[model samples]
Structure formats: C-alpha cells, structure tokens
Target: MFIIIPQTPQNYALRIKQHAERTANLDIRSGVNYRGLAGFLNRPFAEDHRDATVDVTNPAEPPLVCVKSLVEGGRQTARSYHAVSDCATFEQDPPSLVNKAAHLVWLQGYPAPEWINAIGAQYRVDPEFFRRHLIFLQSKDNHDFAAMPSSAQRMLTLRLTTICHTQFALRQTAIEAARNEATNAVRQHQQRLRTGDSVVRKYSVFDNTIFTIDQELAIYVERKKQHNGWIAIVCSDLGKDLTQGPGGLSSPWLGEEPASPPACEPVIMHVPKLALKHPHQHRFVNVTSNGSPLMYQNASLLADTIDLQSGGDDIYLDVREALHDVFTLIAAAESQFLTMVQGLVDREIQLQSSGKQTEWTLSNLRYFKSSIDDHIVNLENTLDFLRHPDVPKWAPHTRSPRALSREGTPAGQAQHSRYRSPQGEAFAEYSRLSSLGDDYTRLLQRATKLSNRCVENTTILMNMAMLEESKKAIVQADGLTRLTLLAFFFLPLSLTTSFFGMNFRELGTGSMHMWVFFVVAVPFLLFSTLLCFWGAVLPNFRGRMQWAWKMFTSGAR
Candidate 1:
C-alpha cells in the first residue's frame, strides 16, 4: 500500500520523530517501522492512502516516505489500517518497531545532510546502524522492485543486480564515447598534417625551414577546436522507485559525489570508486539505448534517438544501433587518415632523389606517428567494449524457448539471458560487434605499420644527408689550409720582386744601408714563419700536444 506523504522534509521528519519517542517510551522497537491503524503495524496499500504535495527547492533533501508491512511469520490481523489514525486504531498495544518484524525505510533521496540531525534531535539511534544501511542503500534502486518477487528479505540481491546493470550500461556508453573521440582525434591530426604541409613549402635552403605552419599555428588550432567535455543530462530510472536500492531514486540520480564518502572511512580503508562518474559524464553523443543519457542531453542539441526507438523496442537492439552509428563514424575518420598517409607515402616514393630531411618533413613525421598511436588505442577500446564480461553475464544463455514457457517466470530473466529463450537473437549481435572490432583493428595495424616504415625511411635519409654534409665541410676546410700554405711559400720572393719594381731613385742606395737589409729581411722572414706556424702547423699539432701532455701528466702523477 502506498502511503503518500507531504514533500516538505519536516512532515516526514515529524512522523519519524514521533515514532522514535513512542518506541523509546515503550522500551521496545516495532516489528514493522510504520504503525498500524489502532491495532498493530499498518498495511497501507491494503488500506487508507493519500497523494503527497511535492516541494523541490531543496536539492540536498527530498521528502522521505516510509513503507510498513507485516514481518515474516507475523500473524495477519483482520483490521485495516487508517493512514492518519494509527495510534487511535490501536486500543491497548502498539506495534513494535525493530523486532521480529521486517522493517524497510526507503530514504527517497540520498541520506539528507540533515537526516541524522533531524532524527537525533529528539531520539538517538545507533551510528553503526545508519552506516550499514546507507551502503546497503547505495546498491539499491527502483528497477529492482519494478520487476521482482515482493519479499523484502531479497532486497540486497535485487539491489546488487541493479548496480551490475548500471555498471555495464555506463561502461558501454563511456567506451563508445571515448573510442569515437579517439578515432576523430586521429582524423583531425591527419588533416593538420596534410594541410599544414604548406608550412614545409614555405621553406627552401634560403627560408631556413626553421619556422613552419605546424610549429607556429597547429597548437593554437588544436586548442581552439578541442571539445571540452560537459554533462547535459542525467540518465537514470526516475519514473518510479523502491526500498531495495540505495534509496529509490524518485529524482534523477547521476553522479553526485557525497561531500564525504561512507562516514566510516577510518574503519574501511579502501579507495573510493569513481566508476559511476565516467558513464554519468559520458552522455550518448548521437544515439539512445538503455545506456543513453537523459533526453535533456539533446534538448537543444539535436533530436534524440530514443524518440524513434521508444516503446517496446529491444534494449540490445537500441544499444547495437547506437554503436553501429558510432563505429561507422570511426571507420570513416580512420579511412580519411589512411588516405592522407597513402598520399604522403606515394609522394615520398616518387621523389627518388632523397638526401637530407628538411626540418618540416621531420616534424610532420613525428606528429603523424602520434596519430598512428591514437588509432591503435581506439581499436583496442573497441575490442574491450565488444568483449566486456558484462555483455555475456547479462545475456540469456543457451536455454531453448520451451524452457522459458513456465508461466510464472519473470520478464527480466527471460530478456536477460544470452542463449536462453528469445534472447539468443540479441546476444548474437555481440559476436558481430566483436568481429567488427577485429576487422577495424587489422585496418589500424596496417596503417600504423605503413606510418612506421615511412618514419624509418625519413630517419635514414636525414642521417645520410647529415653525413654527406659533414664530409664536404671537412674537405673544404682542408683545401683552404693548403692554399694558405702555398701562398706563404712564395710570400718573401714576391715581396723582394715588388721591392725591386719600386721607384726608389729619389732615395739613394747609400741611404739604404746594410742594416736596412737585415731589418727588412729578418722581420719579413720572422713574420712568414710565425704565420705558417700558427695557421697550418698549430692546426695539426694541437691534438698531438694535448695527448702527449696528458700522457706525461698521468705518468708523473
């Protein structure tokens, strides 16, 4: 029985406070948490009910609703519940709160920050009880009860099942988004590599190849074009709710990190998990499925795929169709990259007259190598998603349709099996996706190999060019040294002949004394010798002298 309460938090808190006070006075907690009409624990849906007035200003807190039912083995009374007059309905004895009876208190939202304070203001409860129940709550949601056997004892199992499905849906969504982004990133890199070749063209030996489009503008372009990610909608089951999961999410619950993790941090020393954060952030880009984010994601962005595949469509089909679209985009982007690489490689082959690698070509090759690596990552992600363990775990296994004909079998069991009943048809798609992933991997591998080979060729060509240039430099320096030596050899004779050719008739030979010859010849001879010693001789002698000095010093030491 649904007992709707006012949305205001205070209304719920009031009843909880009253229950605590009464339970304390009586010195015994109730078997069922909520009271019965004038007699025992009330079964509300089986009796009186009312609709709640909702107020949503406070995001941190939502109205709490209590679900009270008979405990296992508790005797059923003929009296019906009065939702408002539970105390009046019970004449002599009131219901016990936490004894032999089964008690389920579904906190509609997360444990409100004020819950403890509100409950504690009047009465105190065990801190451990709150801590344990909250985690049990973490694993619960509305879907579990949406399809279930109504035994509250099986709440934990139902909750865990919800989380498992949640985890997979999240994983599938995140993988698709990430891989698609990776493939597109590679495609974008290729475009820059090809169009940015104009940078290489801007250079000749004169232009110095020092600056290119890639070096100056590519970084800015990438930063500008990069899509900084954001979340648009929360994907969760918000239509209805239950007690089995972390509180039944009446409101959409995506990724809300508590101000703190489970309050008992010192006791349980493990890292807090952020797995939910991923899929919650990675909204489906262009399609819809069980894993798709809320329709609000495409509210102003685009039309949602959920509209086309809404009522009664198979979830697996929706998922595959979404994935197929993504893979197509991935394939197309990769093909463009391959085309660019092929063109570059063909050009490289045709230009047989290879020598030194220009700075432009070398830099471009380095960037292209990064694209090859990106493609490899994209391919691996594709495989990882296709073969995810959850896919098989969630599939209906090899049971024949006849095996599922039992009338009482739940719909979830029938739909979830991979090979069982009608679900084999759905699981068959997993094999196809895996095969597709393999095909794409081969394509990526081929591209990477081609890129690797081209890079190796460029490296070899650059090394050879450097070696040849070094040899030319050495030979030119040697020729310069030889010419200097020959000039010195004829230097004194040339000076003497020039002196004879001079018109020195005005100055008599008498004025030119024997001392003059000594001065002129000796100075010229000394200058010539000094020039030859410092320029040619010292060049060859320095290395030998250094070696000999080092040897002598070592021997002395």
Candidate 2:
C-alpha cells in the first residue's frame, strides 16, 4: 500500500526532490498532472512531488520498497510513507548487505546513517572485513565531520570516538611489539661493542646529516630583522668603496701621454650577514651506523642530527628520527593551540566590534591556555624519556693508544720498571675505557635537555606573537574610534568659521560702523572659539594625540 511521509520543517524536501530527479531519473512532478503510485514511482506527482524514495531487498527474503511523499502545499506535513510489504519486512531485511553492495540506495529513500551503521556492524562476521570497514568508516566520518551541520557533527564525533576506542587498544599492542623489537636490537648491538669488534650499522633513531657548528651565524641572520637600524649601519660600513681612478688627461701633448691608469683587481670580500660569536668544533666518534662512524656535536642549535651507538655496540641510532617524533607531537599540540587562539581572536573581534562594555569570557582562550600548559608538561616528560640511559647506550667507543716515556735516571729505571709492571698501566687504561659509557650517558642527557628547551622556547615565541597581534588590533580599533570622535567634535567649529569668513557683501554697504562692528565681533568669536576649543576639544584631542603618539613611538622602538 502507498504511504505518504510527512515533511519535517527542517528537512530540505525541495532539495531531495531535485536530487531524485537528477540522480534517479524519477520525475517527482510531470508538468501539472498529479500522478498516484505509478507516476510517483516512475514520474512525479504534481500535487506534492518533493519527497525521498528508497528500494530495499534481502537475499534471504523477498524485496520491499518504501517512498516518502510530501503533504500538499504545507511545510509541516505528517511523515507518511508507502511500503510494498509489512513494516517487519523492511525492518528485518538486515540492511547491511544491501547498503554494502547496492549501486543506488538513495533511490529507495534509505537514510545513509542506517546503511552505514548496518554495514559497520556486519563487518564483525569477518576479521578482514572488520578492519577494512573500520578504515572506511574512519575516512568517511572524517570527511563528513568536516562538512556536517552542528547536529550531524555530534553523530560524526560519536563515530570517531568509537573508532578511536577500538584503534587505541590495537595501537597499544603494536607499540608493545615495537618495544620488544627495539630492545632486542639494542641488546645485539651491545654484544658487538663489548667484543671490541669494528662494525658499521645504520641507526633508525638518529639523522644522517650533521649540522655544522654555524649556529652563531644562523642567530645573527635571524636577529638582523629585529635590529634593522643596527644592520643598516653595519651594511653601510662594509659596503664602502676604496678605489681611486685616474682623472681625465689634460691637454699639452696630453700631458706627455696621461699616466696609465692603475689596473688593480677589485678586492671582493664575502661579508656574512652576521659573524659567528664563537667557533665550534666537533670530532666524529667511530660508533658505526650503516658502515660509517656516527658523529655528534655539543652545540644544541648546530647539531641537526646525531647517531648514538646502541646496546654499547657499533650500532648507531639516529637521533633525528627520535627528534622527528618529538617534533610531530609538538606540531599537533601547536595546531590545537593555534585553533584555540583563533577561536578566541574571533570572539574578541566580535565582542569589541559590538561595543559591549562587559568583559568577554573567552572560553577558547582558557581552552588554549590549558592545552599549552599540558603540551609543555608533555614536552618535559618526553625530554625525560629521551634522557633515559637506555636510549643512548647504542654507540660503540673508539679506542686510542697513548705513549708513556720515562726520563734520564728514570730511563735506566724505566726499562726495569716497564719489564717489571706493564700490567699497572694496562689496568689504568682499562678503567678509563670502562667509565666512558657513564660519561657519554651524562653528555646525552645534557644535549637532550637543551634541545627540548629550544623547542619550548620557539613555541612560546609563536604564542607571544599571537598575543601581540591581538593587542595591536584592539589598540588600532580604539585609535580609530578616538579619531572619529575628535573629527565629530571639530565639525561644528569648522562650519562656524567658514560661514563668518565668507564675503557676504550684500549684507551692508561700506561703513566705518561696519568696521567697528567687525572689531567687536572678533573678540566674541575668539572667546567662543577658545571656550569650545579648551572646554570640549582640547582635552579629548590632547588625550587622543598622546595615545597615538605613544602607540607609534612604542611600536617604532
């Protein structure tokens, strides 16, 4: 039997009708004629054509059909629908298979949510199906979440929340597996180093490219933008010309042939944008990674990557990879922080423009502040993790030999002593080599702390810039308002002055009395002008002028 689905006021019935016509080739309205069931399905109903349709089928049961029809000329209509079979048949069809394989589910008026949920639930039958379906759901959910209405956003959020709950458990398992692998690799590396065998190994943890110790040079370049005036002066001094060319030849046999112009090669000095404050040097430690000695520098800014031999062996670990992971975390935190800041800025702009005297409680600002605090804490924790002793014991040590010489009387005695106790010197050397691991561990901790601080400081600087920009915008708005007010107050005075100063010769013939009258009027005019200027204009103008001056000077400095 045919059933009519009423249109909800919020629903886009017209849009649905248009979609059906375009996609399903089902004309909801055919000219002006009103068609019943056949025309509604095949063509369109002229009376109430705006509605949705869906075709449903079950492999285990007979096929069914349902359609939604709008109430005639009414925005609020009873949600009526037509069904070929009983409601039980439509409900019991296990919408999953139809949703998963159907080419045109929309044509039958099956809501997308019902189908998606059905398909997702059905994935439990097969393990691979579950994984693929979850991935699909995640992709679809993310896309839809971005475009969904606020109400729909909640649904999208629920979907993602479920996915996250499921995925996180799996992620934990994966992480545990990875940790085991890393631990095993580290142990193998330590064995090789203990045997004092030379080995070259590639590290997964550290970067290959070593940054040069030119951080001072980098800082100089970076700071130049902030010190524009100082930079200008330095540039001018360096750019001075030091050249004298021969003057044009004089007459009188061309001054016995003008002296030949001195030909000299122009001295070209490459002046760096800024000079390095100090020289930095580093040596490569022969802790091999991938068939090469791993090198690291002490300078935090200068060191782009470092290799640490793992498990006390020649297996070098890439510090860059670890740093990359840290950087990724930082970036995610930064994005969330930025989003919160943007939301605050938007609200602030709206509030200020609306001229509300009440202070705005910017929820986003608080959210952002909280987020940043958490991020900083996380960074500190991560830094602690990096400084853990286990992470750095991967690189092997390079051994060096030193010569011991004894003097004169000692030379005679040294021959006897050397033969008597070569064992003592060897013992001392062994002790020093054994302590090298402890020393390296301490050095790694120091380096890791410095790097973490650099990242933290950079983030702080970015946030400060945002804060300054917001303040600047507010100040600009206030200045504009003050300027506008000042202009308004002066407008009447300007009009008065203009009116009296006009010719207006037709008012009176030339007379001495007119001149006397004018003389008398001038003082009154001056008095009135002074009264208005001092009483109303001067204080406000002075205040605004002072504010502007201060803003400009402060900004310039």
Candidate 3:
C-alpha cells in the first residue's frame, strides 16, 4: 500500500518522522545514509495535468513516474498489459489474476524516495543495494564507491545494476539558443549607441563576447544538472537448486534453463527519465510533433523467438532485447553530442586560420574544453560500471562428452580435469555489455582527442594575437626611424646658416660670403643625405651592389 500523508498538521509531522526513522534504520555500514530520502518523502509530488496543447514528447518536458505490470485476461490466456500511477497496483491485484511466473514491473522516471523504500520492502531487497547503486549512477565522477556484497554472494539472490550513457541535444540546443539571443541583444545595444543614445554608451566587442559566452556557459551548467540514472533488476531465489525439479521454473524475461534465475516476482526496472524513448523512436506516435509521454516505453514485450523456443528460461535475453532500443537511442544522442562539439571545433579552426578569431571564439573554445572534460567523465563512469566485478557471466558452461566419459576412470578423470568447459551465459550479459564498454571507450578517446584539439587551438590563438601586437610595435619603430632621418638631414644645414650669420668681425665686414655658406652647407647636406639613405637601405644596397659588380666584370671580360 502507498503511504499517503493526511492534510492535518499532526499527521504530516507523524509521516515525516516515520519516513525519517525508516531511512535511519537502513544499515549505514556501507556508508550510504539514504541521503535526501527524507526530503523527497516530505515534499508533495508535483502533478502535471494533461493538456491537448502540451507537447508530451518534448525532451525538455518533465518525466512522469509510470508503473507498468502484466495481469491475466482469462484462465490459461495470455497476460494483458496493465499500467497504473502507483506501486500499490502490484499488491492490489489478486495473485490468481496476476502472472506469478514472472512479476515484471517497469518504472519510467525516478520515483520518490518513499516509493523506492516501499518497493525495496515489498520485494525483500536490501535497501543498501538501492542506495549504493544510485550513488554510483548519479555521481559524475568515476571513482569507486564503498564495496557492497553481491546478491548471490550474500543473500543467494540475483541482482544487476548498470549505468547506460545516454545523450540528448538539450544542452547543445539550449546553449545555441542562448548565444543567438545574446548576440541579438548586443546588436540592438550597438545600434542604440550608434544613434547617440546615452543609455547604451558603454559597450565593446569584448563586452559583447563576454556576455554571449557567459550566457552559453550558464546554459551549459544548467544542462549538466540534468542526469539519467541507471537501470536495476532484482530477483529472488527459491532456496533450491533449479535443476532438481522435472519442470524447472524459469523467469519469463530470459532464454532457456541455462539462464540465471530472474529477480523476485514483479521484477522492478527503474528506467531513468534520461532512458525514455525519444519521440522519433515511438512506432505509432507523431515524430513531427513534440513527443509522447512517459508511458513505460522502455518495457519489453518478451516477443523473442529464442525465448519461446527455450520456454523462457533465459529472461536476460529479453532484458538485453529490451535495452537494444535504449542503446540505439544512447548512440544517437552521443553522435549528436560529438557532432555539436566537432562543429564548434571546425568553426574555431576556420576562424583561427583566417585571422578572424574574436573574444567570443576564445571564450567559446574554453567552454568547449570544459564540456569535453565533463563528457569524458561520464564516459569513464559508464566504462567503470560495465567492468564491475559483480556482473553476471556472459557465456554458458557445459562439460565436454570426452571429459564426462573420463570421469569414471583414473586416466579419464585426469583428462577430464584438464579439459576446459565452455563458458555459458549463466546469470549475466557479458558479450553485449563488453561490446558497450568498447563503444564507451571509443567515445572517451574521441572526447579526449577533442579536448586536446581545443587546447591546441587556444594556444595558437594566443600566439597569433601576440604576433599581431609585435607587428604594430614594428610599424611604430619604423615611423620613429623616419623622423630621426629627417632631423639628421636638417642638422648640418641649420649649423652652416647659423655660423655665417653670427656676429663675428669677418661676417660683419662681409668676409664670410653667402657662397661660402652654400658651399659648406650643400656638401654637408649631401653627406648627411647619403648617411640617412645608408641607414635606411644598407642591407639591400650591399646585395644589389654585389650583383651589379658581378654584371660589370662579366661585361668587361
């Protein structure tokens, strides 16, 4: 039954205290304290009323908490699809009416802490498992958490928790939208200033770019706050060897008998909001429209022919089959993220080469570096989860017939002992999960490569800026050289004129002729002019002079 708090003050206090006490009772030896569990329980659920005008399929829309299950339609009849708003539906349905063979429950979005607590209690699962599992999934870092005992190793149960790295264009789209909006605002401000408006006087290219990039950075951070949690499946053991019975019970989720036991009845799969099928992924929904709602789109129909042929002993085959679409969506999202980053990088490269790099380009490059770094963290985390030690084995194991025959004889036993049995998919999904790991590693490498490129581009931009500054300094020095040359040329002419016009006895008696002044000043002027020309052209003159002398000697010869 669901925990419903009454509207009375005393009742609210009682409920809060009860929830807190329940969370506190959870084993803290794992160092997980059910953090924020009480907070989610205390807060009222935000209801989203349906409206025809609302776009349910929009990636930006809030996700709903959907609980999907299977119920019987008739005696010896195929199970019918049933969906409800709460976990209580599982308990409310009669055991006879529900499918006891496999209890399949799918939750689309993150439920309240109370709901998770209730689910854990109902399934008799370790509350610490959910806590630790969530801690790994939601944290952005790739560090290790406090080690917890595996289900099989501790409680003789089956459990699997995996983090899938899914992507969406919400960040890219929102950041770009913010940039355009900022640019338009800046342009308008500039237009106002150009019209001599006093209100828009203090603005520069630097200001414009900083504003735009700051807006983008804010959007980037906002996007980072959104996270898609992990996928968890918990099954209970019947406390007996499955092989002992003639008609062995198998979970409807997996393949044949070799498959591991499925989680407890009414298997609970917490599919994060981030893993919901995109609008384009739905078969009957309008892809052109916004999107469909969070209506258990991730649930598997268990329609695999392999399962049917094997009597559904291997539930993981269906589990893997169900996740195929999720994986595909994740791939698409990753592609989008990479494409966005690459486009920015290409744009920067073009700008840097063409001498058109601006403050915006530089700041944007810094932001790109940060985004790539964040992406690398996510990739590493996903890789770490895939490589977890507690995961179920992938391949099946069967003894060789030769080894079996040898088991009866000493020599045969020796040979059988040496024979390696083929590994099987007992309880885990190895090959598919490993394949995912490889893909994530590849993505991580790509992200790292882009980060390096961003740094390189940033360095080159700084060097080019410095080069432009040096060119300006050289131009100023050239102007100073020209002024010095003019001063040198006028110096001798001024000196000669002054000497002749001085109040000396010879000059008073006209002993100093005007011709003398001209004679002395003209040669001095010519010499000064030559000196100035040498200062300006000596390097070029030396090379030209060598070439001319060579030409004249060749002609004489």
Candidate 4:
C-alpha cells in the first residue's frame, strides 16, 4: 500500500535533481517521472527503511506493517498469514505491533484526527504533541507522496495538514504587513513626485547658471588654445625634432660614423645649384641624363626641391599646431563641464546636509540674469549707434559739431543751433532715466519673485519640521507616561515607608516593645501586601487607574 501527496508551490524540482545528482551520483531528471519509482528510491531516497520497527511510545515513530499475499493469475488471494509489525508482544521486545497498527491506519487515508487522538491517549499527551514530530516524504520528480511507505505516509499527511494551517496563518499576517508597507512606499514616492516640477525648474536655473560659467570658461579656453598654438609654431620654426639623425645627439660610447665632407660629395652640391636655376629642373635633367655635369645639375634640382618641400612642411606644421590648439580648447571645455558638475553636486550635498534645499540659493541664477541683461543692453546700444544719422560712416572720421562747423556754416545755422543743444541734453537725460528705471524695475521684479519663493518654501519646511517634532513629542510622551505609571505603581510602598518612619503612639498603651514590634511588623506586612498587590491587584487596577489619569489630566488641562 502507498500514500499519495500533492506538490507544494515552494518546491523546486531542478534543485532537488541537482541535490540528488551531487549526493547520490545519480542523473535525476526533472518533470513528470520518466523513470520508475524504484530508480528514484535507489538514487535519492536510498536511506529509507525497508524492514524497520519503531517503538510506539516515541512520538517520532509511527506504526508500520508488512504484507503477505498469494497471487493466482495476477490477482491477490487474501489469506491469514503472520506479518511483521512495529509493536512488541512483550514489554522488553520492540514495539512492532504499534508500527503495524499505524501502517494499517495509514493505508486507510492516515485517519489524521483518529491517529492523533490515539497517540495522545496512549502517551497521555496533547494531539499536537504527536503531529509535530511527523515528517513528509515526497517523490523525486514531483512532490507526490503516493509511493511512500504506509506508516511514514500517515505521518507525512498529518505533517502537511499542520504545516499548511501554520503557513496559511503566516501568509495572512505577511500579506497585511506587505499591504501596509506598500501603502507607505506609495505615499513616500508620491511626495517625491510632487516635487518634480520644482526639480525641473531647478534644472533650468542650473542650466542658465552653467551657461554663464561656460562663457567664462570659453574665453579662458580660447586664450589658452591660442597661447598653446603660438608656442607650438615657435617650436616648429626653430627646427626642433626635424632631423632624421639619432634622437637629438647620439652617445659618444656608440662608435660614430665619419662625416662625408660637402666637397667630396660634389654631385650633392651641383644638384642643388642646378635645381635653383631651373624651374622644371627634374624634367629637364631627366631628358638630359647624358649631358655634361649631370651630377651638378641633379644636385641643384634636389636643393630647390628640398627648400620648397621644407617651406611646405613648415606650413603643414603650422596647420597642425592650430589644430592642436582647437583640440586643446575642446578638451578644456569638456574638463570645465566635469568640474562644474562636480561643484554643483557638492553644493547640492552641502545644502541637503545643512537642512536646506538647492533652490534656496539664487546666486548662480542672479549672475546669469545679470549677464543676460548686460548683453541686451549692449545690443541696444549698438543698434542705437547704427541708427544714428550723424554717426560717422567709417573709422577716422570726426562727427562732432565743431568739425561740422569747420567744414561749412550752413544757411540753417539758426535751426541747427535751435535744436542741437536742447535735443542732445534731452536725449542724454532720457537715456539715463530710462536705463535707471529699467534696472530698478528688473531688480524689484527679481527680488519680489525670490522673496515670494523663499516665503513659500519656508512655510513648507516649517510645517514639515513641526509635524516631525510633534510625532517625536508624542513618542517621548508615551515613554514618559509609562515611566510615570511605573512610578505611581510604587506609591503605596513609598507611603507605607513614610508612615512607618513617623512615630505614631496613639493606638492603645504605648511601650518601647510595642514601638519596636510595630517598626518590624508593619514593614513585613506592607512587603507581603505589595507582592499580592503586584500579582493580583495590579492587573485589576491597571485599566481603571489609566482611565482615572486620563480623566483627571483632561479636566485639569
């Protein structure tokens, strides 16, 4: 007979297969059983007992049994035959009968409640005592327990029932906790998300800030690049590193080759001369290869070609120098961006640590605003000059009234005189007043906006801080309340000690012996009363006392 059990969701078939493969040297495959139960038993469950008896007194053991049957034409023939058991016939013998009884009970669906009750009755214990010791056995490929032994199978069924009940209870608690955590997480994320607009505005402000910084950096990079280009050009012109000879100067220890004199190398000298005189020297020389003084003609042609090539090489070097400067400027711009980003990040961190938000500082923003205003002003001034009728058409021309007067006294001198002075003065005054008014207006607008933003942010932070402080106060108050309750709990003891300390001889005939006895007896009585008070009275009084305190404080406050 065999017992069947279903698989649990938590079970991992591949892991079980791996474990079996490692421990038993078996190639256990996953999925529905491909191999027979016998192979699985031999590989993974090899430790399972075939013929074992268990003592029924030990809750860890379940009843077991053996079967004997005679088959005719593949049909079982039931006959009364002696079968092995787990209960002993005698006290000293192993409990073979108990194992047999348990196995029989297991074959009939384990009879969970009945088995638990029977075990409890026999051991004079609770049903849970027997159920807890039970272990579940499962199939290798699937978690099905159909092939397990009868006695072991019954224990497994009861174990599963108990575990499922426990897991169900735990799952409910976990689900509740998870729901609460998710609620809190959503609330927190929502709070952060609400700040998204502010964050975007901050980014825009930061962009403008960095734009101003980059303008300065661009100027610096351009200057540095130009300086670097000049240095490179100067170095190239000085013939530095232009030789094909040994790097710089060769070491004396290395044997030096004898230098060939220019005179001995007559062909070298003559070729340079011929090349200098003839523009198409190489073509001419090729045509007159058999002509007289061929070596001298070749030398002259070679020299001219060398000089031209040298000049072209110088130009190439200058171009390369300029390219290096541009690359340097590009590299500097990249470095400046990195530096600026790092600085901004550091400033943000500092502000956060100091309990301030990044938006509170308008320094960078103000700088950018000022730069834009200045740029606008400069553009307007240039436009004004371009529109001016009397402005000089070109450089080096005078446009002053005195120059105009020196050229010729116009017939409309009185008209020029009539409008010039007053118009010029009015224009000057108007320009100054207009600029002042514009500057003042812009300053006022920026200041007002900044002030309003500050006030709004301050209000938000203050409210948040107050809320946090209130929460902390509530927690502290709770702790203080507990301490106060504890202190009040010992009030009776304190009162008793204080009462005993006072000399009270008003009761009966006062004597020295009575006084001494009162001193000892009163304390002993109070101590016993306190113990009884703590054990019984405190539990009863706790709710009432807490209520009274709440009422009294509510009224008093």
Who wins the lDDT comparison?
3
lDDT of 2: 0.27
Model 2 lDDT per residue over 1-557, tens place: 97654332112223233333442245543221111111222222345544333444222111122111111121111111123223334345432221101111111111122222222232212112212212222212223212213222101110000000010122333433433354354334323231111111111111011100000000000111111110000000000000110112221111122332112111121224526535433322222233321121111111112111111111112122212222332233333333333444445445544744122123223333443353444344333332332221211122121212222355544442432223332211122222332333443344344344334534544565689799999999999968866665566556555556544445564323435445656665676566646768888889999999999999999
Name the runs in model 3 displaced over 4 angstroms: 1-36, 44-87, 91-105, 109-114, 124-313, 316-324, 356-358, 389-431, 480-557
Top candidate (TM-score):
3
Tens digits of lDDT, candidate 4, 134-209? 1111223343433333222111111000000010122323433433354343233223321001000010123311
Model 3: per-residue Cα lDDT over 322-363, one tens digit each? 233334334434545665568768987998788787666777
What TM-score do all the candidates reach, one by one? Answer: 0.33, 0.18, 0.44, 0.18
Distance from true location, Cα of 169 in model 2, Å:
37
Model 3 C-alpha lDDT versus the unseen true structure = 0.39
Q: Which residues of candidate 1, in runs, are more than 4 Å off?
A: 1-322, 352-359, 387-431, 486-557
- Candidate 1 structure quality by residue, lDDT tens digits, 156-183: 1100001101111233334334334543
lDDT (CA) for every model shown?
0.34, 0.27, 0.39, 0.28
Q: What lDDT does model 4 reach?
A: 0.28
**Local error of candidate 4 at residue 359 (angstroms):** 13
